[model samples]
Structures are given as structure tokens and as C-alpha cells.
Target: MNNLPEDCIAKILSLTTPRDVCRLSAVSRIFSSAADSDDVWNHFLPSEFPAGFAAPEGLPTRKRLFFSLVDNPLLLLHDPPHLVSF
Candidate 1:
């Protein structure tokens, strides 16, 4: 696994559950780095996410963005102040 390219490792990680990924990250330095890659985390993000929506300020990576949305979903407002849930 250490000999695998980072992108390849990330792709393999992408197929696993987020919980699996989190656990894998603790296995080794290489696994931890691959788990943190945007390539892996982006696969966890919803496909229907807003095209132009900006992530909250200071969120660093795709992994952080995924966790943020999971913990605190972003809310949008439509006309008439209707709440739009992501």
C-alpha cells in the first residue's frame, strides 16, 4: 500500500464508507495522507450540491467541507424567505 500512488490510494479509499476512511487514516502515514486527499473526500460529497455555492470561510480541504456539511448543513434562502435545505 505504501508503494501505491497517492491518487490510486485515494481512489481506492473513495469506494469505502467515510467511517472506514477515518479508520484507515490511523493505520499509517501514507493512509492518513491519502484519506485527507481531496480526490478521496470529493467522492463523499453529494452529487447535487449547489454549483456556485461557496463553502464557509476558512474551511481548508474537501474533507473539511464534507464534514462541515454533514455536521451543519448549509441553508439557502429563496424568494419570499423560504428556506432551501441542502
Candidate 2:
């Protein structure tokens, strides 16, 4: 019997890069469905950026954008499922 359950699997997946998960999804329907869930995307957000991010006006058409901030050297990464303005 497997020591890790579905929830554990999900948690492990949550920590992985989205690109890695997307590639894994293409291997089978089950992975595809789970990887596509909102939960996975939500889990990815905070870890990917600093707290209290506000998207700028006139956003680009690209699916992802790398932003440079004056205070932070690390580029800000944005994806779909647009973050609600605070």
C-alpha cells in the first residue's frame, strides 16, 4: 500500500512548478484534471510573489509577464486568474 494518499499527492504537487505540473498533466487525464484546478493555481500565488501586489493598468496580452519593481530585484511573475485588487 502506498504511504502517501491523494491529499499528500496534491500537497506535493502544489509545491512543484506550474510548468512541471503542466508537463505531468499531459501524461494522463487524471493529472490533467487535478493540475487544472483552481486550488493548484491558488496555492501557487503567494509563493510566487510578495504580499500586496497591485496589477498595473494597460496589461499586456501575453499569458505571463515578468515585472521589475524599484524596491525588489526579483522579477514579479503574473499569470491568469487575475488577482483581485485590494
Candidate 3:
């Protein structure tokens, strides 16, 4: 548990959902760090998620960008016939 490297823990956490990762963060210091790692969040983000598009001017982390998108999704109206939220 605590002995596991942060990268290893992040790899394992990547297989789980965002909600699950957040819950596991409190289990240990390593878990908390792993949960906040970009590797874990990358798995949670969509495969087609645009690069650098979601990030704000301040250059937020992948996790913050993920939650930001989740809480306030971007509306894509480029195609009038098919409006979508990214």
C-alpha cells in the first residue's frame, strides 16, 4: 500500500474511475500524490480530448482541467446541426 511507488500506484489508479481515485487519495500519502498525477488523469480523459484546448491561461494540471471540464463542460457549436459538449 504505502510502500508502493507513486508511479505504480498511479498506474493502478488509472484503471479506476475519477470518483474512485479521489476516494483512494485519502488512504495514504502515496495514494494522494498518485491520484493527483497526470498519468492517472490521462486515463480518465477521453481519447479524443483535445490537446491544450481545455487548459486555461494559467496552465492548470491535467486533474484540474479534467474536473474543470466535468464541472463546466465546453460547448462546441462549430457544427450547427450537431451541437456537442466537450
TM-scores, all models, native as reference: 0.78, 0.44, 0.78
Give model 1's clash tally. 0
Per lDDT, what order, best first? 1, 3, 2
Q: After the best TM-score superposition of candidate 3, give how far the Cα of residue 80 lies from its true spot, in angstroms.
A: 17
Residues forming the 10-long window of minimal summed lDDT in candidate 2: 61-70
lDDT of 2 by residue, 1-86 (tens): 13445455555667888677668667555566566654555565546654444436542311122222222234444665344322
- 1-86: candidate 1 lDDT, tens digit per residue: 79998888889999999999999999889899999998787788876655445556878788898898788776655453332546
lDDT against true structure, model 3? 0.80
- lDDT (tens digit, per residue) of candidate 3 on 1-86: 78878899999999999999999999988899999998899887776665445466564789987887788776644333322565
Those runs of model 3 whose alpha carbons end farther than 4 Å from true positions after fitting are: 51-54, 75-86
**CA lDDT scores, all candidates in order:** 0.81, 0.50, 0.80
> Could you tell which candidate, 1 or 2, scores higher by TM-score?
1
The TM-score that candidate 3 achieves is: 0.78
Candidate 2: what lDDT?
Answer: 0.50
Could you tell me the C-alpha RMSD of candidate 2 in Å? 9.1
Best by TM-score: 1
Model 2, which residues run further than 4 Å from truth? 1-9, 47-86
